[model samples]
Target: MVSSFHVDARALALVGSHATCETEHVPETRRRVVAVVGPTAAGKTALSVALCQRIGGEVVNGDAVQLFRGMDIGSAKAEPAERAGVPHHLLDVLDVTQEANVAEFQRDARAAIDAVRSRGATPVLVGGSSLYVRAVLDPLDFPGTDPAVRARWSAELESRGPEALHAVLEERDPQAAAQILPSNGRRIVRALEVVELTGRPFTAAMPGYRSVYDDLVMIGLSVPRDVLDARIEKRVAQMWADGFVEEVRTLRAQGLERSMTASRALGYQQVLAYLRGEIGEHEAIAQTTAGTRKFARRQERMFRKDPRISWLDVDDHALVERAVALASSA
Candidate 1:
């Protein structure tokens, strides 16, 4: 049986016809910025493409990992064909060695949105990166980084480990520490840097949920936990079958490990460990699956806190129709 997540021919036709009759008539000034957000493997990509087709929109990538070059399969970045002729921005725009800065992404994404609007197309932001998505849509201010402070935290993380630094974060800002994983040394270091630089709790630096844009439509794909877990396992299996390990091997030679951000990506980290003989291939794949499941849960929880999102079941047969209606009405 075909999964409901797949956009069938009939649905595409309906969306295409709707685009011609309705969305095409809407003025560019009135165009709404549509954001397709959800947990991993919840079919956000398919929905984003379909919605763009129905709304004369361009996709602005909101996923952090997809920004890096050569980190394709594991990021589940849409292939050119999968994009269905829609222009996609921000994918493969950075080298793996460079860390993804959410503050920079906020500026870039808003610029992309403006550029799309200038060309008379709506901007459709799609990804599972909750913070990146929020950075683009919300009025969030990122604290400036002090190189000395950041370097000190980085040194502390390297010497004492992520957990030790995370413990310090717990003492300084329990809310920030609770939100960040103990194993995520980079994020821990960043949080610590922010705390030290601002002389305030890291969590206090974050803004409340409020969008800068008046016309914004946030569509969140909702998948049941059991189904999402199964989908994550299947996705990891597919990644392995699609040369994910080889991709990691190729990137490893390209200095993926030297990258503070890319090296720690879910599958890449596990596969690197496997290549280093720290774990077996089977264990690597297993860990990737388990880690991705946990990450998806976290994504869902973060997105759930925002009341602006219009949640739709991923399995809904009229998913595209409903999404089109939401965007059109906006």
Candidate 2:
């Protein structure tokens, strides 16, 4: 039986039609940007590397968490040795104390893609961050913000907690609230800010299936739920064994707890809880695995909403070759 997560035939047709339309309208010299996307632990990195080797591409980091300078083991960032001499952009762009803004990332990523193309290399975007990837590919715009209004929401989030603020968001924009996690206070605050600023639903700011890039091809990796669950468990176990706790400890000393964005990443959050004596070590590991599984589902759901992606199973032996062919044709 096919999983609901699989891309439909209509999506495949849309991708084909869009590629043809792009070719006709876009300048012949414009380059195509290839996005390798999937749920966590689905081998997006491996596939991206293979594609790069085949097409002489450079990698553009698409995962939000991997932007931090020192977050290695937890974010599964490709080490210098693992990158195998392929140049990577935006891997260590932010300090742990700094925040990651989607609008800024969009601008930086576009410039990186341009730079790669100028050097006669294909730009391959690889990561599990669904919105970040869309931010690069789609014509999405960020709403303007007032510090005072944002501060007020942040205060409310601190005093009343994220759940309470989320309740208010639910009352104002249920659709947006449904998509933003209650624990994700940073995004909740931003959503409320946009609603107040524009007097519109936060979801209204999201662009449709229109591509900002002249030529863009999105390849999604599909994995069975059971297999992905096992992968998540094993990945989390390896992270712990690789001293993820020690990595977090180093970051915490550098003010990771004070950062709004970096502090809330999957494994880092659970490890912080464990460090605070809120949970046991084993519980932290279990929670990380569970949270990752939940995050994987959200990633799949986000990508599935876009009708332009070509989904392929990760277990297929010819997966790399197939992605290369599709991307080249696109």
Candidate 3:
């Protein structure tokens, strides 16, 4: 099923707090950072624009792919016309050739929030990327790396297979090993590096991830499972109709295959498989839809883990009214 943001306002207020410093200003106060989160095709972009219209706020791109240039159609990125004159940050800020990560996203997003507040406008973060959500709203407790530790793991990954090294972690820290997939060379290596430096499993040491926003308001959008699945399929179809294959071809022609991470994103990955004749057009569409559905499920799980987000099971609901009320009270 699609995500159900059944979390009430009271639950949100009670659960969204820790003993950390009160960095989140009061709603209607200066520098308010409101977050809009949900699964794919859940209408977050529309809600964000609505919030901006009512609250004098600006939109910040929190999705991972929307950062890259020429990555528009496949990313399901908010378009210039769809944005409706809202000032957006972090969209099209990187070339497909440049690698971007969570740290960079956090830094850029925080700066955008600060800048919007300086201009006397509220800052509203909008997108489905939950890691980005946690990085800014609730940061995980990942310590700065020791270069020696990182180097050690890096060297090992080069010489030894990831499985052999992951076996080493499975002995010392099974929890960390389980979390790091064998296919995920980067995260697996980082997990082992953290283990070497701190002598503690990375998974075991993750309890310190805390929310930085005080009195923060969150509105999550959810649709029924079947409805969301249909929406995902429809979106994939529309993307193809809107020239998604051409986008992939252009990126490939520009040598963007070197940036495998960007190319592996939802539609692009399936398109590449089709390009290589590994899959036909029908299979490619099915794979992309299935992958998107899976990613949406992951997004739902991610949002549910954050007690701060009160899920809204949207149907024929009046979101603008709810959003306006939240903004006014905030």
The best candidate in terms of lDDT: 1
Each candidate structure's TM-score, on Cα atoms with residue i matched to residue i, is 0.91, 0.89, 0.80
lDDT of 1 by residue, 1-330 (tens): 112112223212212122332344555424678899999999988898888877788788888898888999999988877777777777777776677777877887787788777777888999887778888988888988788888888898889998899999999999899788777888999998988888898778567778898888899999999999999999999999999999999999998998878998888989999999999999999999988998888889888998989999999999999998888883
Arranged by lDDT with the best first, the candidates are 1, 2, 3
Candidate 2 vs candidate 3, TM-score winner? 2
Off by over 4 Å in 2: 1-30
lDDT for position 33 in model 2: 82
| Whole-model alpha-carbon lDDT for candidate 2 | 0.81
* Per-residue C-alpha lDDT of model 2 across residues 1-330, encoded as one tens digit per residue: 112112123311211111111122222323678889989999998888777766767788888888887999999987776676566777766778888788888877887787778876678889787778888888888888899999999999889988999999999999999887777889999999999989999999787787887778889999999999999999999999999999999999999998788998889988999999999999999889988999888888888887889999999999987987877874
- lDDT, each prediction: 0.82, 0.81, 0.72
Clashes within 3 Å, all models in order: 0, 0, 4
In the predicted model 2, the residue pairs found to clash are: none
- Candidate ranking under TM-score, highest first, comes to 1, 2, 3
Better of 1 and 2 by lDDT: 1
User: In model 3, which runs have C-alpha deviations exceeding 4 angstroms?
Assistant: 1-30, 144-189, 204-210
